[model samples]
Target: MNAGIPAAARELTDRLGPDAVATSGPLYDRTRRVWNGAVTNRPALVVHARGTADVQAAVRAARDHGLPLSVRGGGHDWLGRGVRDGALVIDLAGMRRVEVDAQAAVATVDGGATAADLIGAASPHGLSAVTGTVGAVGVAGLTLGGGYGLLNGRFGLALDNLLAADVVLADGRAVTADADHEAELFWAIRGGGGNFGVVTSMRHRLHRADPILAGTIFYPLPQAAAVLDRLNEVLSAAPDELTVAIAMLTGPGGAPGLGLLPAWSGDPAPGEAHIDRLRRLGSPAFAKVGPTTYSDLLHANDEQGETIGHHVACRTRSVPHLTPDTVSALVKAAATFTSPLSRVLCGQFHGAAARVPVESTAFGLRRNHIMATIISWWPPGDAEPHQTWADAVSEALARDALPGGYPNGLSPDDTTQIADAYGPNATRLRAAKTRYDPSNTFTATPLP
Candidate 1:
C-alpha cells in the first residue's frame, strides 16, 4: 500500500472494498483515459462505481476530502471533462445496464450506458431511442448536453426524449427528476449539461423504428461546393423523416471527398426518391444507400476508426443557412486541411427538433440550423498544426454563423461561445443551477 495515498481514498476503499477504488496502477490508468488523446489529466483517486450507491459514496468521499470531482460514463467527451487532474473521479464504466419495457416503449438506461448499449437493448422490441450518430457516446452526457442525432428530424433530440433521470446530487442525496418531480432540475438537465449532479440512470421514450433507409454517398472533393448547395436546397423542403449529415474528409485511398450520410425513417417507398435526389446532386465516386437497421447506422462511425488514442481538437459553428459564402468557406477549409485525419462535419437540425419552443428547455437554439463541427486530429505528439487548422476554419465561419455554437461541442474555455449558447434561457438556467447546486460542486460543461 502506498503510504502517500489520501486518507479519504482509504476510507472509500474500506466502505466499497478494494476492487472499487484505485489510487494507482493499471486500473487507474484505464479509468482515467478519455476519448481525446490530447487530455492527459491523472486523477489521484478513481472509484469504479458499480451502482448508484457506489456513485453516492464516491461523491460524498470527494466532498469530505475537499477534492475536485468528475464522473466518467462513456468518456468520449472531446474536451475530456470527465477526468480532471488531481481530482477524485467516479468511474461509471462498470454500471452500464439497460432495461427496456416493450409495452411502454421506454428504456431505463444506466448512466454509463452508451448509445450502442441502449440501441442494442431496444432493437429487439422494434423500437429505437433518439441517439447521436456515434455509438460509443455516453447516453447521460449526450442527453444532458443536447443530443443531436439522425432521428432528430422525426423524434427530436435525445434530451427531448428523456422522460426522467436518477441523479446523485452534490450533497449526496439521490433523487428522481421528471416532469412532475424536481421539475426545474428536469428542465435544466434537458440541455443544461452536467453542471448539477451525476445522473445514475435515465429513462428515454422510444419510437417504433426498426428498418431505416440510410447510407453514405461520396463525391470527389472538387464537387464539395456544389454538393453543399444542393444539400441546402433539398433540405429546405425535406420531410420530417429525412436527416442528412455532410462531411468533407479524406477517404481510404488517400483522396479527399465530400460525403453525404442520409437517414430516412419513413416508409421505404418514399425514402428511395429522397435518396435519389442526393445521388443526382453530384457524380458519386462511391455510393451505398439501402435498407438497414438503425443500430448498424449508429455503429458506422465507430467502424470507420473514430476510436480513442488520437490527439484531436474540435470547433463548432451554428449556421442558420448554408449560403454561398458559408459553402465557399467550408470548401476552402476542407481543401486546406492540415492533417489527413482532419475533417469538417455538418449536421442539419430541423423538423421535430426545430419545432420545440426555445424556452421549453435549457437548450438555446431551437430554430432550423446547421451545426458545423470542425475536427482536426493527428498522431500523438503532433497537435499544433491540426489545432491551428481547426481554429482558422472556425474563425472563417464566424461571420456567417449564429451568435453561439452548440453547447455540446463548445469547450469550457470558450467563454464567448458559452455565454451565448443558452440565449434567452441563460438567466433561468443559472437560477436552477443555484437552487440545485449552490456550491457548484459539479461542473462538467461550463454553464452560462
Candidate 2:
C-alpha cells in the first residue's frame, strides 16, 4: 500500500486487494483524468469497482473514514465531478457490462457503460436506446440528468426511458428503484441527477432500430441569420419523428458556418419530404442527408467532438423560441470566437419529450424550447479568454432565454442556475436528498 494515502483509504486497499484499489502511482494517475482536460482534481484513493458489492464497500469505507466520496462512471462529465481533491473515488470504469432483453425491450446496463456500449448491444438486437449526441458519454450520468438526443422526438429523453436502477445509497445499502418500488427515489433519480446515491446499474427501455434519413447540411456564415430564421419557422410545425440540432461552427478550411443536423426516426418515405424542406432553408455549402444506422450517426458525432481539443469551457441557455434577437446574438458570438474550436450548438426539445407532464419526473422545463450550448476550447495553455467568451455569449442570450439551464451542462458552482433549473420540483428534490442522503456523501451534479 502507498504510505501517501490516508489510513482509511489504505485499509480499503487492503480489503479489496492491490488490483482493485489504487492509492498512488501510474494506475491512480491514469484513472484520475476525466473528459475535460482542464480538471486536475486528485482523489485520495481510487477504488476500481467491478460490481455492486465493490461499490457498497467503497461507500461504507468513505462514510466510516469521514472522507469525501465521488463516483466515476464513464468519467465523461465535463465538470469532472468523478474525481475530487482528497476524496475517495468509487471508480466504476471496470463495470461496463450491457445485457439486452429483446422481447421485453429493456437493456440492463452497468453504471460504467457508455452510450456506445449500450448502442452496440441494442443495435445487434434491432433496438436502440435514447442517448446523447456523443457516444462516449456515460449512460448512467446522462440518464440521471436529462438526456437529449436525436431520437428524443420519437421517444422521450433518456431519463424518460429509464425503467429501473440499482443504487448504492449513502449508508451503503443497496436498493432497486423503479416506478413500483421506491417511487420517490425513482422520480428523483430521473432528473435529480446522482445526488441521492451511486447508481451501479440501470434498466433502459429500447426502441426499434430502423434506418432513417439523417445527416448534416452546412451553410455559409453570411446567411446564418436567414437560415436560423427559416429553421425556427420549420421547427415550429416539425413532425414528432423529425429532430434537428443547429450549430454555429468552424467548417472546412477553418471557415465559420452554420450546420444543421437532422434525424428522422419514422418511415423514410415521408422523412424524405422533411429532409428536402430543410435542404431548401438556405444555399447550402454541403449536405449529406441519407438513410443511415443510428450507431453510425452517433459515431460520426463522436468523431466531430474529438476534434474540439482537450481543454473546453461550456455555457448553456434554454430559449423558448429562436427569435430574431436570439439568432443575431448567436451569429455575433460565432463571429468573435476566441478560438477556431469554439462553437454554439442548439438542440430542440419537443414532441414526446415535451409531452411528458412536468410533475411526472424531476426534470424541469418540459415545454418545447431550444437548449443552446456555448462552448470554447484551446490547446493546453491558459483558458481564461475562452471561458470569458462562453460566459459572455451566455449573458447575451439571457434576455431571450429561460430561467434555468440544462442540469447536465451546468457547473456545480452555478447556484442560481441550479435553483432555476429545478424550479417547482426543488422542494421535493431537497426532501428526497435529505431523506436518502442526509449527510450529502455523494455529490454528483449540484442539488437545487
Among all windows of ten consecutive residues in candidate 1, which has the lowest summed lDDT? 1-10
Displacement of residue 411 (Cα, Å) in model 1 is 1.5
What lDDT score goes with residue 105 in model 1?
A: 96
Q: What value does the lDDT take at residue 260 in candidate 1? A: 91
Q: What are the per-residue Cα lDDT tens digits for candidate 1 across 40-105?
A: 998878999999899999888888878888888888888888998888899999989999999999
Per-residue error at 147 for model 2, in Å?
0.1
Per-model C-alpha RMSD = 1.6, 1.7
| 1-448 per-residue lDDT for model 2 (tens digits) | 2343577667777788778888689989888887778888888889999999889889998888778889988777777889988888988889899999999999999999999999999998889999988888889999999998898888989999999999999999999999999999999999999999999999999998568689999998999999899888889899899999989999876989899999999989899999999989989999999999889888988988874337878888999988888998899888888888889998889999999999889998899999998888777897888888998899889889888899888996777788899867889999999999999887888777
Q: Tell me the spans in candidate 2 whose CA falls farther than 4 Å from its real position.
A: 1-5, 307-309
Model 1 Cα shift for residue 278 (angstroms): 0.5
lDDT value, residue 362 of candidate 1: 95
- lDDT score of residue 299 within candidate 2: 92
TM-score for candidate 1, please give it.
0.98
